[model samples]
Target: MKSRSLQPQLANLPNYKVRESHKAKHVNLKISPHHGLEVVVPKGFDHRRIPEILQKKQKWIDKIARQFEAQQEFLTPTAADQGVTEIVLQAIAETWRVEYVPTSNPHVVVTEKPGQQLQVRGAITHTDLCHKALCKWLAHKARTHLVPWLRTVSHEVQLPFEQASVRGQKTRWASCSQNKMISLNYKLLFLPPEVVCYVFVHELCHTIHMNHSAAFWQLVGEKDPNYEQLDAELHNIWRYVPVWVEH
Candidate 1:
C-alpha cells in the first residue's frame, strides 16, 4: 500500500506519514527510530481528522520521540553503515566474519567458507540483495539447528508437536498455533542457548495449553525450573541482534 506524507500543521508537532491498511480496524500511531512517526488508519478513514488526533496525542508523541532519540545510537547503524562485517550467534556459540566479493553474476549468492567465514558473491554492490542473501542463510542455519533442538526438547518433555518452521519475524521470537504448529524466529540464534531452550519449551508447552494461563506456567516451570528468570532475559536481548538482519 502507498503511504501519503502529511506536513504537520503545528510547528511544534513532529511530522508524520499517514498510511492506509486494509487489516487495520482503527487509527493507530507508531513511533520507531527507523521510520519516526507513522499514523496508520483503516481504509476509507477520514484524513481530515488526523491533525486533530495528532494534537491530542502531542505529549505522548513527544515523550516517545525523546525515548527513541536517547536510544538511537544503540538501536541500529545508518543505512550506509549496515555493511555487515561480522555475525555472532550466541545461541550456538559461533562467530562468523562476512566477506563480500564482487562478481558478474546477476544475483548475490551467500556461501560458507572454511575458518568460520561467510562469502557473499555476485553483485555485492547491491546492499539490499546482500541483506536478503544473508537472511536466507540465517533462516537455513536456524532450521538446521533449531528444528532438531526443538525435537530433542519435545522428546525430553514427552510433548509431541505437529510441525516446526522458522522465519525472520520482527517482533516475536516464536509462536505456537492452535494446531500444534510452531514458528520460530531465526533471530533467536542471537540469544543465549538457555534462553533459546526456554523458547523451545515455551512453544512446546503450547501444544498442550494454548494460552498463558497458570497451567501453562506450571508446565513450563516443570520443564525449566528457572523459567521466570530466563523469560525475563528475553525482554532485553533484542539489543544484541544485528541491525542488518532487520533491514
Candidate 2:
C-alpha cells in the first residue's frame, strides 16, 4: 500500500504504543471513531522492523487519526435527533402496530390493515421475540416486493441464480454463494421499494461475480445505474433498526 506523511498538526501527538512477541507476522493498524487506535501484529514478526514501518507510514497514520476524529463528530447525535431507539419505536408503531397479530405459532404475519398503523403479533412474550417477529414480517414483505425485480435484473445481467430467500441477518443485507443461492436481509422491508430492489439485485449480481472487483461493480451498474446512491440510502435506513440480540 502507498504511504503518505502525517499532517503537520499531528506531529506532536503521542505515538501509539506497540508490543511485539514471537506470535506476530506483520503489523496491522486500525483507527475508529469509537476506538482511537488499535494495532495488531501476527506471531513471529521482527520487533526491529516495526520502527521502520511506522516511520514510513507516520503521515498516513496521522491522516487516519484525523479521519477518525471527524467520524466521531459526525456520529455524535444531537438531542433533537431521535436516536436509534426512537427510530425503531416509530418504525414499529407506524408500520408494525396495525399489521401485528399474535398467533399460537411462532410466525409473524404482516398484512394491510384498514388504517395506517403497522402491526406486529407473535407467540413469544419477550421484546426479542417481538423483534424477530418484526424481522420475519419485514422479510416476507421484502421478498414479495423484490422478487420480480430481482428476476428482471438477473435476466438483464445474464446471471445464473436459482432462487432468492429472505431472512434476518446480523452482519450483511444480502449474500450470494457459489451455489447461486441468494439470501436477503428481512429488515429491508422497512426501506423504500427501490432500495430493497437494490439489495436483491446486488446479491443476484454476486452469483456471476463472487468478488467486489471492478467487474462486479460494473455488472451491478449495468443492472442498476444508481446502485451507489441506493446503497448509501439503504445503509442509512439500517442504522435506525436496532441490532438483533437473541434472548
Task: Give the number of the best model, judged by lDDT.
Answer: 1
Every candidate's CA RMSD: 5.8, 9.1
- Please provide, for model 2 over 1-247, each residue's C-alpha lDDT reduced to its tens digit, 9 standing for 90 to 100: 2223333544544344444423234576544333334455565555556556666777877666565455453445442122112223332234433433557866554444564455555653445555555555566665775566677767866776887787666546678877898886655545566776677778877787776668888989988899999875653353344444211
For each candidate, the alpha-carbon lDDT, in order, equals 0.83, 0.57
**Candidate 1 local distance difference test against the native:** 0.83
- Lowest-sum lDDT 10-residue window in model 1: 1-10
Query: In angstroms, what RMSD does candidate 2 have relative to the true structure?
Result: 9.1
Off by over 4 Å in 2: 1-96, 99-113, 116-125, 232-235, 240-247
Task: Tell me the tens digit of each residue's lDDT in model 1 across 87-117.
Answer: 8999889999999989999899999999999
Q: What's the lDDT of the predicted structure labeled candidate 2?
A: 0.57
lDDT of 2 at 83: 18
